[model samples]
Target: MELHFMGTGAGMPSKERNVTSICLNMNEERGTMWMFDCGEGTQHQILRTSLKLGRLEKLFITHLHGDHLYGLPGVLTSRSNHGAETHLDLYGPAGLRAFVETALRVSEAFLGYTYTIHEVEEGVVFEDEQVRVLATKLEHRIESFGYRIEEKEKPGRLCHEKLKALGIPPGPQYAQIKRGEDITLTDGSRLKSADFLEAPIPGRQVVILGDTRVLNKTIAFSKNADVLVHEATFGQEREALARKYYHATAAQAAHIASEAKAATLILTHISSRYQHGEEQTLLKEAKEQFENTHLARDFWYFSIPRKTASHS
Candidate 1:
C-alpha cells in the first residue's frame, strides 16, 4: 500500500501545495485507489499526477468543511467525463449521505456510475482478504473522523527444500502443506504443515488523522502505528488561534504522535500562510517533539509494505 498526497495545504491552496487530498494505492484486485478529503481544485491538482480516475472505488470524507470536501462534486463529475464507469462508495459522518446526494441532485449532474453513501458511525468501515480499516471520531467542530488501517496477519511461507527432503514431489500434496494443511503421505503417515512453514509475521499499522484538535482518543487509536498522518494547520506560536479554530498546531501534532508511539509522523494539512520557502519553522516545531517527523507536500507517496494475507 502507498499513500500519495494530491493536496497537502489546509484552508486554501498555495503555489507549493493544493488543498487536502490523499490517494492510497492498494492495487488492482482490492481497488486501484482510496481517496481522502477532496479539497477545492483537487481534480486540477490530480492532473499533475498519473492517477487513474476509473479505479477510484472509495472516497472517505473526514469532515464537512469546504476546505476539506469542496472538490468532491467536481471530481465525481470529472471522473464520469474521464471514463469512470465503476460504482463508487462514499463513507463519512452523519449528514454525509444527504450532503453528497443533495449536491448531485440539486446540480442535476448525470453520472454514469452509481454511488452508495454510508454514514460512518465507528468500527470497521472496509475490509477484505488483505486489510481492515477502522474509523474513530476525532475532536473537531464538525463530526470529523480519523482512520486506523491495519494490515491483517498473514500466512507463513512454505519451505520447498523441506518438502524435497521428505521425498514429497512438487504436486498437490506439497501445495496443501504449503497452505498449512495436514495431509496423509504415501506411507500413510500424516505430514504436519508446521514443519514446512515459517512463523507468521505481523502486519503494518497506519493511522490517519483529519482536521481536528489533538485528543487522547486520537492518540490511543494511533498507538505504535508504523506511520501516523496528522494535521498541522499552524506553527507552535499560533496555539491559541489553532484552538479557536478547532485545529492543531505543529507542536501539538508532534506531541500526539509521540504519545501514540508512532514510528513516523507525517504532518499534513499545512496552512497557506506558510510560503513556498517558509516551511522550515513548521518542520522545526514538530521535530522538537518528535524526531521522525516529516512535513507533507503535494504528490508525496508512502508505500506501506504488504504482508502475506491470512488464509486461515
Candidate 2:
C-alpha cells in the first residue's frame, strides 16, 4: 500500500505547503483509493499528481475543522464530472453528514453518483474481506478521531520444492494443497497441506491520527503499527503553545512512535512558519527522539512494506 500526500500544511495554505489531505492508494490490492482529511485546494493538488479522482472510494474525515474538510464540495463535484457513478462512502464525526449535505445543497452542486455518509464512533467503522478500519477518540480541541487500518493476512506461499520432494505432481491437487486442504493421493497416502505451505505472513497496520495534543493513551493505540502518521505542528521549543492549541510538537510525535514501537513514524501537518532553511530542523529534532521518523512534504508518497512471518 502507498500513502500519497496531497497536502501537509497544518492550518492554512502557504507557498510551501497546502492544508491536510492524504490518499492511501490500494488500487493494486483493492482497485480503489481511500482518502483522509480533505482540506482546501486538495483537488488542485491531485491535479499535480497522476491520481484519478474517480478512483477515490472512501473519504475518512477526522474532524469538523475548516482546514480539514473545506475541499469536499469541490472534490465531490469533480468526481461526478469525472464519471464516478457508483456510491461513495464517507465516514466522519457526528456533524459530517450535515456539513456535506448542506454545502452541496447550498451550492446546488448535483452529483451523478449517490453517496452514503457514516458518522463514526470510537470503534471499527469499516470492514471487508481485505481490510478492517478502526477508530479511536483523540485528545484534540474538538471531538477528533484517529484511524487504524488493518490489512488482512494474505495466503502463505506454496512450498514448491517441498511438494516436489513429496512426489506430488504439478496438477490441480497442488492448488488444493496450497489452500491448506488435505487430500488423498493416488497411492492412498494422505497429503498434509501444512507441510507444503509456509507460515502465514502477518498483515500490516497503519495508524493515522488527526490534530491532537500528545496523550499517553496513544502509545497503546498505535502499538506495533507499521506506519504511524501523526501531526507535528511545531518543534519542541513551542511545546507550551502546541499544548494550548491542542497540537503536537515534532519531538512529541517521535516520542509517541518510539513508545508505541511503531516501525515508522511520518510527521506531517507542518506549520508554514518554518521556511526553506528552517524546516529541516524539525525533521532533525524528530529523528533525535525516534530514528525511524520522517517529515512529510506535499505530494510525497510512502509505500508500506509487508511484514513477513519469518521477521516476526
Candidate 3:
C-alpha cells in the first residue's frame, strides 16, 4: 500500500501545509481510495489534483476537531454534484453524525449520495477477512482516536521451475503449488506444493495516529507499520510545549517509530513555524534513529503493489 499526503499541517492551514489529510491506496482490486482525516479545504486540495471524489470509498477519521473535520461537508457535497454513484462510509468518534448533520443543516448544503457514519470507539472499528482496522484511545483533550490498518497476509509465490521439473503441466498445478498443498497424481505419486513455493512476502501495515502526546498509544498502533504517519506539531526544542499541548515533536515522533519497529516513518501534521526547507531537518532528525524516514507533502500519490493471483 501507498499513501498520498493531501494535507500535512496542524490546527490551522499553512502556506506550505494545509491540515491533516492523507489518501491511502490499497489493493488495486478495490478500485477505490481510503482517506485519513479531512481538514478544512481538503476538497480544494483535491481540486488541484486528479483525485476523484467518487473514488473515496472509506474514511477513517481520527477525531472531530474542526481542523480535521471541517472539510467533510464540502467533500460530501462535491460527490453529489459530481454524480458519484458509490457508497461512502465514515468511521470516527461519537457525535460524528451530529457534527455532519449540523454542518450540512447549518450550511444548507445538499448531497445526493448514500452515506453511512459509524461513531467508533476504542476497538476493532472495521474488519473484513482481507483487511481490518482497529482503533485506540489517545491522550488528546478530546476523545481522539488512532487507527491501525492491517491487511491480510498474502500467499507465497509459486516457484514455477520446481513445478515444471516435477513433470506437472503449468495449468491447475500452479494453483495448488501456491496453495501449499500436495497434489496426488492419478499414478499415485504425491507432489508437495511447498517444494515449489517460496516464502510469502508479508502485506504492508499502516498506522495513523491522531493529535496526541502518548508515546505508548502511538507505539501500539505503529508496531511493524510499513508507514507510520504521526504528528510532529512541535520542534525538538519545544518538546515540553508539545507535551503541554498534547501534541508531539519531531524527535518524539521518530522515537515512537523507532520503538514500534516501523519500516518507515513519515512525519506529518507539521507546524507552519518550520519552513518548507526545514522539513529536511525533520527528516534528518527522524533518520538518525530510523533509517527509512520520509516526509509527506500535499498532492502526492502512491501505488500499492498487487498481491498473489488467487484461484484458491
Instruction: Evaluate all candidate structures by whole-model CA lDDT and list the values in order.
Output: 0.86, 0.92, 0.82
* Backbone clash count for every predicted candidate, in the order shown: 0, 0, 0
Off by over 4 Å in 2: 164-172, 186-188
lDDT of 2: 0.92
- Best candidate according to lDDT: 2
lDDT of 2 by residue, 56-157 (tens): 999999998989999999999999999899789999999999999999999999999999999999989999988999999998989999999999887689
Q: Mind sharing the TM-score for model 2?
A: 0.94
- Clashing pairs for predicted structure model 2, backbone only: none
Give the per-residue lDDT of model 3 (tens digit) for 42-130.
Answer: 99998897777788889888988988998888888987898887889999999899998898899898777788999998889888867
Q: What is the lDDT of residue 253 in candidate 3?
A: 86
The candidate, 1 or 2, that scores higher on lDDT is 2
lDDT of 1 at 106: 99
lDDT of 1 by residue, 196-238 (tens): 8877767889888888988888888999898899999999888
